[model samples]
Target: MAIDDAISFKKLEVFLAFMKLNNMARVSELLGVSTVSVHRSLHSLEEAMRCPLFKREGRSLIPLQAAYTFAEFAQRAVEECEHGILKVRETAGFNAKRLKIGSLYSLTLRCIPQLMIGLKLRKPVLDIDLTLGSNRDLLQQLADGKLDAIVIGVHTKSEFHDALDPELLSIPLFDDDIFLAAPLNSPYSGQTQINLTDLHQEKFVTLADGFVTSQDFWYCFEKAGFSPNISMRVQDIFSLINLVSGGIGYSLLPGRVAKFSSQIELIPLESNYGAQQRITLLLPKIRERDPNLLALTAECRMYGRHDGKKDGFL
Candidate 1:
């Protein structure tokens, strides 16, 4: 016979409790419901099944052979449903103990570490796996579900670049200005502002093409109507900084990296060629409500509010 709409998983649960305890008051106490509610659920279950599964006797329920048989199936159904829920959650990375995060290598100097510490405080048991790469690589990994979240830089004026995926959600952390990175002893180091066109003859070091800084480098130079004399291209920001600091060449970098090394000087670019990098946190919209991601988002927002005032990175 087909089951009635009143035969729900909740009713099955109440039925199982009643079968186990054999007393209405006990089942009510265990399920945190009124005894009257428990009795109503059991009555509904019997009506839906079109079979009497219990023998009622003065505020007590006595199980018959049919009740015991039905209880076995009910328990299995509940267990299987619970297992399915667990598998679904695991597939979605929901409530997982580990959080896999991706980020730009440049942010490791300041932004990433501070966020990590705050995230740990908020979720003490959560294990964080960090992957550092260029902005393009990180964004791709996040889109593919290889990483849970990412911290990267994007153009401030056009926050959503053409390459950015619309399916992802972004949180603005802070706005950082791009500067001309030069060796401490360079002649232009004494200048407060340097025009990009004037540096056309100067050899420069830069991060590889996939990095946001590399895009910024090309954009500023293109606006200046001259391509830079690039002497070296590196994959990571730290290496590019080392090359610029060692008098190898000049490069364009964000102001947040200013505290990384005193050997390099950051000079503002001419207003017409100036660019700003907005450091942002991105996550998949599908997993935005996950507990771990929620905590991480909160930490990022807190950091964005205080990091500017505390570190003067903005």
Candidate 2:
């Protein structure tokens, strides 16, 4: 059979399943078919590709190098198909304009809401589905096609340049300064300057692991040459502020969050430990030309441009 005629969607699906599970029985179980059916599909796929995808050894079938490479393409193809199906269904049955977005929980306060509103004004019929999580989670969702774009904080240093996936396209939004949050009545609240070492004995509150703030909080301790005495770990920035307001423990946060509460005081660090966090909009390069995503990118850039000019960061 010619390559075009031999390859079927089900065959590719079975090929991907075999690559992942590496067991005919398991692939069959996952595909809701008999093992014999899965075996036939695998044979059909290998023949269509005209390449050795596996090496049989005893009762085990070890995948060849080409199999790994093919699996990557297969996964992408499957995801794109699913994406197309979803778009079609949303347009046909729902008759509702839809765009899926993910963001760091912190941006919900100012950045995300503004972007969504801007997009809505440009496309009044558009409906946005927003998912809020940590930087890592949002990025994962974007790469998985669960989100069209993500707003997150990237370190302005090495991490900004090196940590992201090469295939992801990013747009820098603004620069935010990191600050320490303390109770309004705390002694540190009245201080002209404070070092992390000065608060060595004082308990601290922190965002739980996986958040960008959590990493920055630890980075401060590393810079101050001491370990933080963390008293609590919360899921969101608001909760961290509430804890500080109630005299639970002091915490470090980006400047944007300081406006959320007047009960807490923000203290600027005296040393170079006050690193700037870069707020960024990230999307998959593959979806760069998507119409809905293009509109979103335009709004984000327009907002960034205007905000940057207003703030003198452009």
Report the number of the highest-TM-score candidate. 1
Give me the candidate number with maximum lDDT: 1
Which residue runs does candidate 1 get wrong by more than 4 Å? 1-11, 14-65, 159-163, 309-314
Residue by residue across 106-158, what tens digits does model 2's lDDT show?
77766788899998888888889999899878878877767778888888778
Query: Which RMSD does model 1 reach against the true structure?
Result: 3.4
The runs of at least 3 residues in candidate 2 whose Cα sits more than 4 Å from the true structure, single-residue gaps closed, are: 1-96, 308-314
Clashing pairs in 2: none
lDDT of prediction 2: 0.81
In candidate 1 the C-alpha lDDT for residue 19 amounts to 78
Cα RMSD of all models vs. native, in order, equals 3.4, 15.2
Tens-digit lDDT track for model 1 on 1-314? 66689999999999988777777789889999999999899998998888888787776677889989999999999999999998898887887989999988778877899999999999999999999998878878887888999998888765446556778888988888889999987989689789888877889888888888898888888899988887889998788889988999999998878888888989999899988888889998888899999999999999999884444344
